[model samples]
Target chain A: MTEGSSVPQRCWQIDSSRKGAEIIRITDADGKSLIRVKPGVSAVIISSASFLEVILEEGARLELLRPFLLDQTLEREVSLSVHQAKDSSLTAFMVTKGSISFKDNVSVVLAGEGAEVSLNGLHDLSNACEAHSLTLIDHVAPSTKSDQLYKSVVRDRGHSFFHGKIMVRREAQLTNAYQLNKNLILSPEGRVDTKPQLEIFADDVKCSHGAAIGQLDDDQLFYFQTRGIGREEAARMLVKGFVKDVLLKINDPLLRAEAGGML
Target chain B: MLNIKDLYASVEGNQILKGLNLSVKAGQVHAIMGPNGSGKSTLSKVITGHPQYVADSGLVDFEINGQMVNILGMEPDQRAREGIFLAFQYPVELPGVPTSEFLRASYNSVCRHHGLEQMDPIDFDGFIREKMKVLEMDDKYIDRAVNVDFSGGEKKRNEILQMAVLNPRLAVLDETDSGLDVDSMKIVAHGVNLLRSKRNAMIVITHYQRLLNYIKPDIVHVLYQGRIIKTGGPELALKVEDQGYDWLIKS
Candidate 1:
């Protein structure tokens, strides 16, 4: 067993040589670890994902990378049950480029006070391909906070699906949580389904969720064209701006640049 | 500098501009006065090559260096490249597009077409700042969305701002002075007059003659029954303002 309160593990990117990859590890209290997986790679987490019943040495970080169309998939199941830990953060980037699908299920128990979780997911799907993303975040402890924001843009006949759920238990008081999903449909046939749901049982909690799915604004497109930009180029720029908010939040620069190129 | 001869157009099979003709020379401002349904808006859309308005037959030409080139076949963007600018009556509200970016693109397109060097970001920002001063617009408008959530007066000022940046050879102001207060009208006219060079021309389209009070036109054409039936000097505008377009129904 690895026993250390302030030890740093070198960041690791999943070895893509294998057809599939799996990782199962537990992070002890006051421990820090970094993991990055590249394209054509798969990652699964079976242990506690963040600071919960297990104390996450302050500033524990996790990075997941999913490159463009790779005939590969990403499946993650993480649970955080921190009771009294303070200042523990989890940052993950699940980038789906080209034709890729990702399924993420995350649950956080905030028996502890002053714990925070931030999840940012971005899917860059273009051409006549499809990309799917599903994320679930749960709040079971009081005085805990969580935020989830996912954005996607579909060009051509590209299709994308996003389903985000936020639940606040009766004991989770002073819980500040928000979930937002926004998608832009570029073509007439391009499709996207976004459902953002919130289940609140605590009487003194602040939680809100919103979902918006629409095509490019016609007036904006005409405004650009009248200024000398053709229809195709204007459409491309609008789509790029839609996905930028998600890409900018990713902690990894190389992954952000690669995601921008895929679009 | 501009001429439209025997123009016929319609929207969704409903004829609007039926055999219309007009001409404007350099160093002159011409006001087109007409009723609401008398095809005034249709003429503006047809001249700018709006896709919705189908032109069955007509010829629009812009004289460059004493050479008349037909522009009916050109698209709206193409017409803009050939020095034709239309200040829309109801400016479109583009929510996501930044005002500065749109202006720079338009300014650079025209300059590139005329074989002029493209203005860098610093120069472009300065150019717009100076022009906004003429319209009394604030500096914050530079980053706002194009006409998005702007008041009536602000939208009109934005149109003039675009006109000042583009500096086209022939400017077609379609009801630029409508829906503006007396103060905003004066500011819009001041901007228009400032851009009135000897080598450029203007065609101001409006229902009332109030706009003519600010930017006095050299000629005024009374459009009735989809055609220009009467032509006179600036006094013609006052006559219609007092008498109204009801007289055209009889003539």
Candidate 2:
């Protein structure tokens, strides 16, 4: 279904009931989208797909919260793109969990001067699942800023890949961009491949990226155990703390609580 | 009360505690002094059930609620919940878990083991604040990550603070004064002294006699080659401090 060109004041939610291959275009200058995937729907047979596009005109503001619950084996894909105009701002929070094979592609372009973008994502994978998330952020105009943080927890034989690319064009001077990807592997068989790429053609721009993948620290675990916390409880505490900073990026209290419960 | 007889322990195929024996009674502080590689640290680990250590033979017994409990087969956490606390020589740093949350969880876990009610967050904060005051610690430490980016002295003080919070029946401090400065050492000693009571016991393991000056021990034992070679009063630590362990090892 297509949302008209008028600005939207109310939140919009898209679910599996919409069926295969849906596109949502947000052309309004100050429109917002709160897209949440409904729970307990099996995506294996549905093969659902969604595409989201947001365009922010001059001096416009937009916020998006997309939390997906993938409790069963499912194959699904989501594509998101955003274009910001001069003095425009966009903030987005996305969380995905429990997909057998899932793919997400997100692209944001700061095409106008004084534009800003902040994107944060959290993915929780378990039980031989394969998930991939790719994000591309482009700073095309001067005085544009963008920040991205993505964290994932992999358990059992699950595998996850995060590829983030931030490009600062030659004309995008005074551009401030930052990107980080951190993963926690809970089991020996779990695997995570994270690549944080930065392409900066402007000499005066500030850009940085970091990626890390590791298991729980033995010493830290022992510290908790020594405090009379059971092994299971200590592991749970560590995992919760590992993803807490990223999860707090979600401003909605209900959504934050839901995401925390999933972890 | 704690008792160990002919304790033989090893780690990674290396026997660290060979035929070691010791006993500690409630309301008493026992100081174990020895040279490096003399199983001083290993004895503490064996008592606390460190995962890396393997107990080949012998038994570790603790009197809990007037009953002798064999702690040899217990898990590390089980041993802890049974009122056994080990203040590590180097406390591990947890970068994201706040100190207050960790301490409260630990306290509540032990409380739950004894069929007691858990303290609410507000009450726990107050309890921890009072405990920190005993160590002369700042209130800022409660909000920071557990031992993360802490100075050497602060880490030692934090260990004492944890011991105070847990209030274990048997506390084994492993070289707690190793990295502490003079002022920090006194604060730590003061905290330990305040925790002393007739219902609890402490085993202070150290390499020097300097720490003995502050927290005076009732008995001092010289550990050598995985065994206690000499047992004496507080004067034994001073003897080791004056002449070092060379003469003891040669004997």
Candidate 3:
């Protein structure tokens, strides 16, 4: 556990060498935290449980980056919960690669007025791996906003499932929410299931959700071939282009490049 | 130099070009005027080996460095590498691929086909900037995605810019001047005129004589129902502009 009045400039990195479950808490006012979990961190999780809980004080901010690398024989499960106070903000980026089976559940609560949240994620799965990601965002106060975008690319026999739920209580008036999920299937056996749900009880709220599943555009591929580009190279370029929008959300250039290469 | 003899083509079980024959010599510009659905665009697609257009029967040959090769069996990319270029009437937009990177990839592919050395990034940037000047294009377009969110005139200009960089032996312009203002038309024609040389041939397809007024054509052919019905000097374009395709169709 780490408690402090202020946050350091650098992100708090989890020890990849450690094993078993761990928990961290932050409750100080104006406290900030940046959590980064690099690839292969699941190898140290010998136990079946691993969880992270973050509590943000008023006007505080939290940023999280979880880039997962595939481990063939490992199955990992992780749960994350975030509670935002008045005028606080939370931004998160989650990217995952291969795993035999991986499950992640994320919950966010905008408990105070003027709270905002933005969440973006990408999953690149290949082989016989599977990934399930579930997100729940709750608006309990007035004048709250939330935006979410998630994309997945499945290849070979890989499968991915994404379920996002946004709920606005009766007292949460003047709420604004948007959610979008997109998937690209590369092979015939690749599969993706996405569901975006929004339940708003406030009369003055605005909410929209969208989901799309598709393959590479054949016409665009042929257009590239006309310019003397080989089919394989053209396909690679198109895949990168499809995910470029989500990757752009990452502010770090080096990390963005690494994410681009994974595709 | 290119030659097509008794070409027949179809798309999705519907015949478009039936026994079409035409010839274009080096150092000459040929204008093909026709009404809508006269198979003017089909000719260009057949020549470039578009996947959708199937050439049922034809002899399409091109002279490349003194070697006459039959291009009917080659792929679109192969024909492109062999010095055949087509400026599409509607250029496709690639949302996330930068124009500079796309152009570099294309240029290097052609270079590799010809056993030429590839240009480095800095050298390629300088080279593309020089070519962009010919089309009067702004410097910002190179950094943006290929044709993404480009205006009509800008898309046409970008097509010409690509032609200037590729420098193909046989160039086909399929309604390149369909939608353009006076200024943009002049810029596009100027770019085309600058690239014309004695070693290259051009086949310009259009429905109106507006583009011909800028880039003068040596020979004018009236195409109707997939065949060249009439061939004459540049004066023929004036006749079609004065009258309409109704007279030619009736004749």
The lDDT-based order of candidates, best leading, equals 2, 3, 1
Angstrom error of the Cα, residue A60, model 2: value is 3.5
Per-residue error at B151 for model 3, in Å? Answer: 0.7
What's the true lDDT of residue A131 in model 1?
Answer: 57
- For residues B1-251, what per-residue lDDT tens digits would candidate 1 score against the true structure? 78889988898999878789998898889899998788888888887777778888888887855799887777677777777788889898765557887788778877887798999889999988999998999988898777877899999999999988888788889999889999999999999999998988999999899999998899999887688888999988999999987776687
TM-score of each: 0.78, 0.88, 0.88
The ten-residue window of minimal lDDT in model 1 chain A covers: A75-84
What is the interface root-mean-square deviation of candidate 2? 1.0
DockQ of each two-chain model? 0.35, 0.68, 0.68
Question: Looking at model 2 chain B, which ten-residue stretch has the lowest summed lDDT?
Answer: B61-70
Stretches of candidate 1 off by over 4 Å are: A1-121, A143-147, A204-206, A240-263, B64-66
lDDT of 1 at B180: 94
Residue A48 of model 2 has an lDDT of 20
Report the CA-based lDDT of candidate 3 relative to the real structure. 0.82
lDDT of 2: 0.83
Full-model lDDT for every candidate: 0.71, 0.83, 0.82
